[model samples]
Target: MTAKEGVATGSVPSATPTEVADLARVEDRISFLYFERCSVSQADNSITVTDDRGTIRIPAATLSVLLLGPGTKISHKAMVAIGENGSTVVWVGERGVRMYAAGRPLTHSSSLLQRQAALVSNRRSRLAVARAMYQMRFPGEDTGGLTMQQLRGREGARIRNVYRRLSKETGVAWDRRAYDPDAYEDGTEINKALSAAHTCLYGVVHAVIVALGCSPGLGFVHTGHERSFVYDIADLYKAELSIPVAFRTVAEEPVDIGSAVRHAMRNVLYDFSLMDRAVRDIKALLNDDGMADLGGPEENHVGLWDEKVGEVAAGRQYGPDDGE
Candidate 1:
């Protein structure tokens, strides 16, 4: 292929990897950007987005996540740029009701992932993590003796209270939380708004989870499914973030409540610095040592497991009798 063709097809030399320390902190970055019915390609360090309206350039380094909706086509060069900068790319259905995500993490080490696995594997530690989650939602309250069933019931009551209070304050009619993924449009304005807002929340949270190199399927309070952990983390912010935003959006009576809710949620996420909170919260939840960043160096590493000593250095040849 010609030089121009090679560049366009992303067959040319890849860009140098950026240092993790030089990259923007997740809390300081924009939450997400949504695109649909467009074509995405890389130009230098920026990704060019083209649609009927026009073509625009966006720096790939500053982006946290890109939500590609229906009718979007992204070239390989664009994906390379996104992956190089530790940004996530997610494919979604209309109003973000359906989603699939893939990304490169900011950290190369598996420290946090190992910690999460260790915590979730044991029943005692898992229960502690679950209780810690409940405590985060209900600060200043004791959850030490509460069984899982009681804790769930308490959460239900808290959410019901939030809905009723928000409904009374906003004067938006409230019945119950009813959602059907297959029929998003059939729900009430509030339900539709809630779904849209929560989808955005889940997208960002999922991006954070991936960027940290944690398994999205391993969860504490939530279990099963590929995104069970995504649900568990997203629930931490729903009452404060999505629920209120949904109620207020419906009260405005906008022509398109879904679009309005998404915009509001974007601003809310930024204003609250949720990305930083998510990182710290996950660390605190899994680590008994305390909530520290635990970020590692940029160098890639590997080790071999030794039953007695644990994690011997790899890449060295041993004697014939030493199990090379």
Candidate 2:
């Protein structure tokens, strides 16, 4: 996510609605913005966020996700503008501890989602994708021969090493990963930082998954949850992005650890260009056609499926007498 920039103020514009083609590419846009206790409405080509302080306008076209935290309200006109801009809106609890709802996919095409479903549904393809995911984390090493159990073991060891290394470097005490969701205050400072950082990362990953029209429930490594795919993708970056940040935040011993971690995470995401990397990584992971990019096109399409051939034309009546 890019740094939050200053906003201008204006009235909602009365002009031609935004076209998908006019919107910025997903990789080229700002990852997300979090708002709370504010009123969101449309203003000209931007979205106006008004609070007790004042209202400010944010460019809707370049924003990929809008996170509305507790005590926030939005207008229908603002939602329409955001939807037209292909931006995803997510509702979450304070400090982004809980996720309540999410908006529509940014992409008009369902091609990537179809490919993801197909890959996850088949045993062979699902294993291939899972291995690919492992291969991503273990670059310069081949994981083709590793079974699911072996992969899980390897991953566990790898993460433990990460925690130990980061703890040593930051001089923060390291312990086993422990967190009680119902009791946030019960977790250690590092654990709280980890949760806060991971939640922010999950929010971004969830946005990217849906923006590409991919299913959050269809996952190769994770399953049996509404955000299985979100966890799967978020894991890809935790080692580099969140883990170190959490340790560093704990070392600082900030007054509000969660807020500090979130702020740090946003900057880290911008510096890493994580949004662009995520789009590219997801394409290569799911790309089986040996093509350059498998992220799919931005065009909207609807069609009828056929058995013998591929897809058939949509919006036409199929009559036996006419065909005969």
- How many steric overlaps does candidate 1 have? 0
Against the reference, the lDDT scores of all candidates come to: 0.85, 0.83
Model 2: colliding residue pairs: none
lDDT by residue (tens digit), candidate 1, 75-112 = 98789888977888989898778889998887776777
The ten-residue window of minimal lDDT in model 2 covers 1-10
Q: In model 2, which runs have C-alpha deviations exceeding 4 angstroms?
A: 1-16, 288-298, 320-324
CA shift of 21, model 2, Å: 0.8
Cα lDDT tens digits, model 2, 1-324, are 122223324663343456555667777888778889999997666889999999888988888888888899999778877876767888877666777646566667777888899999999999999999999999999899999999999999999999999999999998899987778888899998998888888888887787777898999999999899989989999999999999999999999998799789889999988888888888778883543232345246688888878798788888896682
TM-score of each: 0.92, 0.90
For model 2 the TM-score comes to: 0.90
